[model samples]
Target: GSTMSQSEAAMAKANPMYNSIYSQLPQYFGEQPWTAGPVYVGAFVMFLFILGCFIVKGPLKWALLGATIFSILLSWGKNFMGLTDLFIDYVPMYNKFRAVSSILVIAEFTIPLLAIFALKEILSKPDTLKLKENRGGAIATLVLTAGVALILAVAPGIFFSGFITTQEMAALKQGLPAEHLAPLVANLTEMRKAIIASDAWRSFFIIVIGCVLLFLYQQRKLKASFTLAGIALLCLIDMWSINKRYLNDEQFVPKSKQTEAFVKTQADEMILQDTTLNYRVLNFIGFPGNTFNENNTAYWHKSVGGYHAAKLRRYQEMIDHHIMPEMQETYQAVATAGGQMDSVDASKFRVLNMLNTKYFIFPAGEQGQAVPVVNPYAYGNAWFVDKVQYVNNANEEIDALNDILPTETAVVDVKFKEQLKGVTEGYKDSLSTIQLTSYEPNRLVYKTFTPKDGVVVFSEIYYPGWRATIDGQPVDIARADYILRAINVPAGEHTIEMWFDPQSIQVTESIAYAALALLLIGVMVLAWTQRNKIAKKS
Candidate 1:
């Protein structure tokens, strides 16, 4: 919630052991380590990017230059941690984003646009010596771009050593017991050197080719038509050939393979048979990444896991503190019990049960059937808690969740204290019951009969959009158990409804429609004026 203080935001962003540098280590990008550090913008663009600085002029040139420089700095990925930290700490929504190197796309885009302008300037004024700016631009582009290319071709390792993924891989493997890794690492090191040298040579050749064409055009030895065609063809060849190394024909799979990707496996078919409304499935088979970071499980059932880099901060906190640790504990228990998960007590995994994880998908058996392990203690849609445990801050609130029994108690932040004023002192009675009468995407109805006013915690994730009502009278919804919903109900049988009414959306939609109508009217008026002018001229 936005109610989290500045200190809490900082706490949330803090990672003492992990940073941009640490992320280059193996498995950081999970099976795709090459994605960790990539700076390739293509050889053609590299030459043009450097040349554009000298040739391109005016406010647009300065804008392009500024964008290119800042993006490159940001692509350093917190090698400038002080500056990056400031953005994360103070700048709105900056801290929420990631993949620092993604900023290079700005440089990539602006470079090509500036390069086209640079090319136009050269083509329009072939005689470099005619204008002082043209002559200066030509000399600068050649000396700087060609000279750097020459150096890169000769000493490729000097500039790029820090960004090498192979070095990180070697360091990571050295700590393990793999005897074969020594030779593999050695081979990879050689391959890395070859790739670096090849890229450098290729870029140097491309730059020389471009410089020669421009020089020839200036000397009148080649026509403008020939020069433009040569440059265009070179750019196409350079970009295409280089990209082919990464994305080639061999990478394409058969139609059957593509079809098989989404084809519901026997496991999925089996799980779909359970017509229960609200329960999550945990699919461990084909789990290459962490459970929550895999999306395939979601296709067949309400998976207890999913993949999203920008998931809600509070939910991620729950995953770290509650879900992951509980999952590990459950795995350890099953292993200890000789892989018989049924022998393990479901009560021990209080958090998982509260999440309503009813089924666990295991690997295929001898008969090629997906094994489904059922969790018996899964707490359904909503449950009446015995008490409410309130904490002063988010950190304290999340910390309190570690000790409490989720089914019996709810850990709530103190910010929601006003709404929970009446039921701060909780009640628990066998006669008091709450049942989910109906469920819809936006609305949930519950029939409740309580001897006295008490708090009922819903398994559904709490969001600001959700509004609670006790017989149509609006009541506040408290964020409980770090991410779930909780509301207080008065004594006696009552009809309770919770609706996801994101009220601001309605206002935004109306404004959008009004703006569209205004735009249409303006367009019509402009078209009418243009038509009148044309008619008068005729």
Candidate 2:
């Protein structure tokens, strides 16, 4: 939950259009507040390769060196002491991404490539100049690795204090009691110190063993093949052992369990029985907490919430402005009543119902069971609105939702009002009705009847791809109620269809098919031309 909130906050702040509070927290900007063991082990390997640059010379060597330095600087994040701030401020799109440590993937690749080049140089047939120079470089690298390791082993605290700021520690305190905070902090500090000391000694030994093998190969005391095999074995063992500390066989589940991971629960089965298929489910059991973003509900039902790294900005804004606040209010009410609320307050869930959430799931008294409650006030798939209230901006449009009857009225942003050409204002047709006849991920069809021209609002997210047609004639789809689809419907019975057919997708697909056909034709021509040459050779 902390990670998700921090990531969301970072994303919101990075995008200037969003109305979110900018956080200055370290974790929000990809700074590690605690020790990461695997990173330390990986760093040791990278250091050895950095040293190898002294002997590994070529055009590829220079390219690798540049990549390695850039990757290292990015991976250092805010820890480089203000260097990363320059990139965040001046570099295009740098501030948009988090987890700066992941940039080390470049270093990971270059380090291994350099390591192989250095090993080849050391094992190759001795030429006096090259062999003498490489051996000295190898010795210097070994000394540096050993010296750093010895210092860490002797006084780990000298480099890292294992102390985190109060604000940093507060991020981890969610859902934890006050009494346990002090003990947890103390234990964390001790654990980090121990990891640093142990990994330091482990890295030292691996480097020393690698140096020994290279020294033997250089001296001609060991066969090249044998020396190479020994060094390879040493690297494999060193990396594997260190990695096993964090991940191992026990971490993997059985194939059968993996397959059954999203199998329908009792509550899910009950909810699926509705058969309406046009509504969404809100699973309160795992909501507003650590597992809130899990997609278990989405596996079988249209869910109001699901997890994704890059969610639609408009949808996220809707969640922030409407959904979360309402949910929090309901939770507080339940808490005040000593956690014995009989049912979710339907009045408090107006925003959720507007999003077409028709079912709510909560943990039952029995351990493995859950209760699914139907929302009585949920609006159907599509509805005819009596009035179109225009708001000047996004903030006003969202705020207007609080007082508007979502089923009876639609709130349209003034910026988008220009897109509504034939849409009529103050148009109320009480006799008009609309029902969703068919639904697919990319297409939706609705049957409607209107005594007079009226606007129809669909509880579907408005995105660029969707195109709406009324009886085969295309019409503009408007962004209604901040994040839903709305279209103007003429009087009389008509078929309204919406299809997600993006021009960009169609163009890219056509290009891909054409490229494939050209490649095939080229291959055939080459084979035919080569046939005569083969016949002559024969």
Candidate 3:
């Protein structure tokens, strides 16, 4: 029942949007308003025009020099490092605004440089510097930088960090219903990510912005024409560097789409609708990011991968073939008692076995109470259904899991469990393998209620020494106790994972050795090359 229509679910996806004067008056003007991309492009072009004036030997070259100094300061202080991730906590919609603003900055540099390059090719002179004074260009740059800084400072929180949170509360009060507000808040955060991509579009915006400002100066009254042209060249270089990255491929969907698709598919395959199937088949081939198929392997774990894998594998072996020792034993007893096990029953078994083709419905009971195993995927806690039998339930010959036929003198084959040897390389003889009672996708969970005797070993056979912590406190844990580590945990839940140690012989040693070797080789090559070059010149 916890389901949504496709269109309704799509609303939850991230879509970041920002507005400017153009957007506000767009209805009347019809598409003249500049978007975030254009603004960034414009800014970059303006920056380069300032740069070009300084490089060329011309009047107001001092002003061009001043612009260069300002560009460096603004680039680092106001642009590059100015966008901090911490603002999201203070400003309610700061994340969304930040993303779009960042993109605009890139566009500022890209578009201007492109125009400058085109003009140079048309003139057929690659190296020429001619510039005159652009009266108000300096003031404009200063004003833009100052405005951006002010916005950063007085944004939601000027006095105290706590005030930012307070402003958020006040803003939300007069808006949508409290229930609806949470979803919107979540959506805004996602939108921020879309606008923050470090890609070509951003570069394009920066160049364009720089060009427009220079072009303004080039107008006779404004003067500095040649300087603006040179600045455009610099913007072009930056833009080309940015766009060249995506020259090969085009059809790239956001990674977020793939992750969502995988989760939805898993959810759909988990509902139970039938109760007579024994075997389930899981095809893990198509699921993205290393999803395990349910048919080949099965195990008990809270993860969907484990549950589906186990259920389908068990169901297929038992129900489809009807050759499992347990089923064959049960059938022999019923047949001896004069009930014939016919081809019809075998056909029903086949249908039931194949129910894992998609997924079956399973019933959940109260916490701690054991439910009948309806789904082979979800066992122990729920009643599962064999989807195949659900459709053919009216057939009187259906020997469902619910039907308890009498058993004959059939015996179960005993499989002896073997003790595994430790895989630790150096001290294999000293360490013992720990028995895992349960496993999650990324971890194996084991319980040692009491500490094991004999040097308390944790045998691990991985390269790069792992970190060992006692109750989350870092300790001087060594590789010796890697596999069967003896540690004291509280009687409740305990977590452990193989942690990487950089100082050990695993990673750091190799890097250090490689560095030393490279240094020595470089010195030898330099001495030989210098001696040969001098001899040849003589």
Candidate 4:
């Protein structure tokens, strides 16, 4: 959840203990301690400029210093001496965001500002004394930056020593084939070392070039524009080269390719042929990123697994407790059977069926084609439960799901007992039917016929703004099956419509329309008044 209260306590508890500056500083500062390259190479180039600003005394310098210091402190994250913790505890809204390291954006901004200010000051008044000071500062900055680069370039092993832990190495070996493990590990270590050493030399060369250009300008041998341009060019080339290494032209694909990226596979094509798109699809291929809710599957179908940063708490809880565990169990079973469980498992179809997953997509047997397995047990959009088990708390509600048939039984928390006072449970009538007649992202309509008054749980995530009406009369939607919506239906035929009607959204829309109307009226009045004034002047 994006809200602070959801994950703040857990994040605070997970803060790493900072032992000493030398030991922990590298973790927070740059990409890697051995490499001169940082996560943001542009920021690193500006950092050298910031160091040079120290010799040029001004109010701007002090301001930049203060901002940079604050940024650095925040960027230290859990590595610093409890400063981040103090902020999260006492500062309002500070704990709302998780990545404290992102605060270094301020430092990145301040460094360039200070650097530009220093350059302007030096160029504006090129007195011998000021030039000498500038020369001294430039030399000092170059020496410090270059000396570290030199050491890294000469002997990277002295500082880094292939910092992979024994446990990490073992894990790497375990993942690889026995015959290839040793050679791969050795090659990977050498590659990492080479990258660091190479980047160090690259940084050293750029810094030295910048220093020489500044020195030439100080000596009055080069024009101000030329010197500045030369230094800027060096910084641009250095940062661009480093950046290209990560995000190159190859990363981008044509629009057609991007559209084709989500092309319907053989399994997807099979699912699409169903015509009844009431149910969701569960892709066993898993999410592209670490997150369960990524939009990869959602690009084509209403996926049970879709990405959202501030996903509904109950939905996340459902995934954590029910979906993920079942998937993991399937994976473990395959692994135990001496089969490489790389892609999908058909055995975990039970959980998918409960989520109303109509089609399950999995990797075809070594063919690279997707195979869609139709779930026979999938409950339709809505169903009448045979019984409702009232639970005291969330834990019990989740636990009750393990034994109950999801299509014929629902677990409702005791907190909702009052809402269900008029609603009857255990009223099973096989003749009753609920079919999804119309659907939209924000609205759903169901044509339902009930043999008797009963509760019908809908396979939709229970969220705040969803409102339900049976035959245009408002009905209470209860949280059923831990994360789905359930509403009581009368014995007769009724139009059950659920729509997202958030008051906040309505209010925001009204305000926007009103503001636009006012602006248009004001513009018309002003134009009329100006016309009369122009006539009088004429």
Clashing residue pairs in candidate 1, if any?
292-306
Task: Give the per-residue lDDT of model 2 (tens digit) for 1-538.
Answer: 1221233323432433211222332231122544333253343355457565877778888888789888888888767848778878998887766467777778778888886776665566444224566567655765677778878866766775444556557665773577766765554444344545666777777777776776676677888889878877887787787577556677599988876888788889888888884899877775586224788888889988777767877888878888888777755655465444455465676777778887767665758356776766688788888788888898898899889888778999887786666354635556788889999989999999988888888889998889989999999999999999889888899999999999989999999999999999999999998998899999
lDDT of 2 at 486: 89
Q: What TM-score, computed on C-alpha atoms, does each candidate reach?
A: 0.81, 0.77, 0.22, 0.72
TM-score top scorer: 1
**Candidate 4 or 1, higher TM-score:** 1
Candidate that beats the other on lDDT, 1 or 4, i.e. the better one: 1
TM-score for candidate 4, residues paired by index: 0.72
Report the C-alpha lDDT of model 1 over 1-538, residue by residue, as the tens digit: 1111112222233243333322333322122223523555656666666666776668998998888888787767558887677767888877656567677788878878888877787788776335776567666766676667677667755665433354566665775458745554444344344445555677788888887888899899999999999999989998887566556687699998865666687777877898776788886665435587667677667877787766887877787787777777776675577557668977567778888888877765566355777777788888888888888898898887778887788888888877777355666689878888887878999999989888888888888888889998999898888888888888999999998879789999999999999999999999999999999999
Candidates ranked by lDDT, best first?
Answer: 1, 2, 4, 3
Clashes of 2: 0
Task: State the displacement of the C-alpha of residue 438, model 4, in Å, after optimal TM-score superposition.
Answer: 0.8
Question: Would you list the C-alpha lDDT of every candidate in the order shown?
Answer: 0.72, 0.72, 0.34, 0.69
lDDT tens digits, residue span 367-482, model 3: 32212222222122111111111112212222333242111010111110011122111111212223334433233334333222211223222233445443455444221111
State how far residue 169 of model 3 sits from its true place (Å): 9.1
Worst 10 residues of 3 by lDDT: 408-417
1-538, model 4: which lDDT tens digit per residue?
0111122222232223211211222211123223322346353355355554656586867878888888898877767858988888999988766456667778878877777776666666655325554567655665677877889888866776454556546665676568765664454455445555766777777767776666678789999899778868877887787576556788699999978877666677777778784788877664333327456668877888777756777777778788877756654554464444334444454455667877656655666456676655577788888877788899998887777777777788878776666343656676888889998889999998887888888888887788989999998888888888888777878899999999889999999999999999999999999999999999
